[model samples]
Target: MKEKWRLLITEKNSAYRNMAMDRAELVSISKGNTPPTVRFFTWKPRAISIGYFQSLEDEVNLDACKNLGVDYVRRITGGGAVFHDKELTYSIVIPESHSQVSKNIMESYGRICGAIIKGLKQLEIDSSYIPINDIIADGKKISGNAQTRKAKTVLQHGTILMDVDVEEMFSLLLVPNEKIRDKMISDVKQRVTSIKHILGKDISFNQIADAMRIGFEEEFNIELNKGILTDEEIELTNKFEKEFFSTKEWNHRR
Candidate 1:
């Protein structure tokens, strides 16, 4: 019999709620209230999430986000700003002491990203993990991930782009001037890629989720039993959303 883990396939939500749920799962697993979990989710109305160490005003164009009706939030994990649209975002919460988890951050990243690479292969896309935390296909980035460990637990979450809009993404991010902005957008278009771009067709989210589910199971040698959030997790999610992710104090904190 294979080791069993919880799997959560959630609907689209605001940036705040998404970040909150990831943190909630981290907290729940750390407290031994829930099994280690793998969760996949998306953003509704679109959003921008900045790294924990980032300054919101420096990284995001608040006026543009407001005008475009895109939500903005700060994540507990460290990474650059990410525009969340047309992507399947995944999070895994596991004990740091789990047999498969390495204390070395780089090694841990490589192991978890192997699962993502396998998932992409199932979609017929050849991809590889770039050191630090990125997945590239055909020399262009298709996924970006970030990880944080707390209370003896590991929480890693990342985005797998289904499609990308360089122009729209640049519109919501801060850039020095029009000249620099235009050049930066051009540069990113060359660097970033997505499933639609790679496969030359649109793929449904369910299909991607299913592929990732199998990828994780195969890489970890575990059975992922589809599951729902516990009541305590739900309560924590609400608290985190209200107190941290959705608050200006948290989002604006450098």
Candidate 2:
């Protein structure tokens, strides 16, 4: 008795386009206008996404991001800052009526983390779930997820590190002082490790994507329909692209 799913795969999209599409998918699914969607996307030119409630002037070094030519956007979900390089990003949008859907944040997080844990297990990583949203292997985080539930739909998305540039991640995120930055670097070093770093080999992006697809399908017992965004989603995405995701005000709001 597996729930069926539809997929949306956008290999390389601009930061603006990616965010816009996610928003549109959320609305479409919430309204029961679209099926559950799983999307894989990567930002072209790379970027840093701030959490929705985060303050731009306070949480990021805009000047450094600009100097580095890193585009910036604020996500509709809540989470800490993340560097989106060498990572495969997934966005899952489910209708509120889905039996597997969770209104409680922790419940939803656990299910998704369970899926991620299973995915990493395929790579022989022996991963497990950590509270407050993470997939950990050997006590180090490999994935981080965030979610937004509104008007009867849920949009959950996260990052899986294929490789990490530790120094660059620390540089882009704003820290009150050098001491905090140093401490954070140490903390991330202690707490996070990429799959490539742990495996001592590079895993193809497709391999990870398949792992995720299988994990989620097993967890939800759903027959996923491998596909892309519909014409309706595309039309709505185009509208969102101009109205919300690319705006400066949206990027900076607390």
Candidate 3:
């Protein structure tokens, strides 16, 4: 059996640094320089992150994001755009050869997201995994995840909604048509929920992190020893942030 996984509770950071670090960790793990890692982090100044294949203009209101001081970045993983405010984000990197990491995407989502569902359950929030990459409670989405595989390493990261600001989210994210924006907002309100909504009160970030930690430990039967980013990952992240995530060429590639 594999030994303890590395767990990092990182300080809040800019959108560019967060995404850069995620890819850096993946690179480090793939090269056998770091252990499988689980990292929990938050965004500073709030942010919106889009998937690798998304069209920046088509999916986001760049002017609104800039005007409101909300940072935006493109993830290396493929998925829809996500508003990252009032949420806890987690990223896990494991090699393909790990017993817990599955070869199939759906199967991998099932196993990785199971830890999320289990964690939510610990909070008295009854939730289930909806295929592809979502966790739902009372038939509404409470979490969304995305994954990318590279160099025989899998990087899976997701958002755990602490609160949902439909209006703010809509302001920064584009609707299919301006005319139907209201309807879209209404639909999203009905379909999405958060920890505060389910629990009917605010939950501290550390509280949620603790629950998630136990969930992963219990579900995967692997201890997550607290750790920090290695020197190699930090170096890579610094380089990638400047060359990739901080550049318009990468974010607006589409």
TM-score of each: 0.98, 0.96, 0.98
Reference-based lDDT, each prediction: 0.94, 0.84, 0.93
**Regions of candidate 3 where Cα sits further than 4 Å from its true position:** none
What is residue 127's positional error in candidate 1, in angstroms? 0.5
Candidate 2, residues 110-139, lDDT tens digits: the string is 987787777787888888878898888878
Error of 3 at 91 (Å): 0.4
Residues 1-254 of candidate 1: C-alpha lDDT, one tens digit per residue: 99999999986988999999999999999999898899999999799999999889998999999999999999999999999999999999999999989999999999999999999999999999998899999999999999999999999999999999999999999987767998999999999999999999999999999999989999999999999999999999999999999998999888
- The clash count for each model shown is 0, 1, 0
Off by over 4 Å in 1: none
Error of 2 at 4 (Å): 2.0
| Superior by lDDT: candidate 2 or candidate 3 | 3
Give the Å error, residue 94, model 3: 0.2
lDDT of 3 by residue, 196-220 (tens): 9988999988999988988788778
Error of 3 at 183 (Å): 0.2
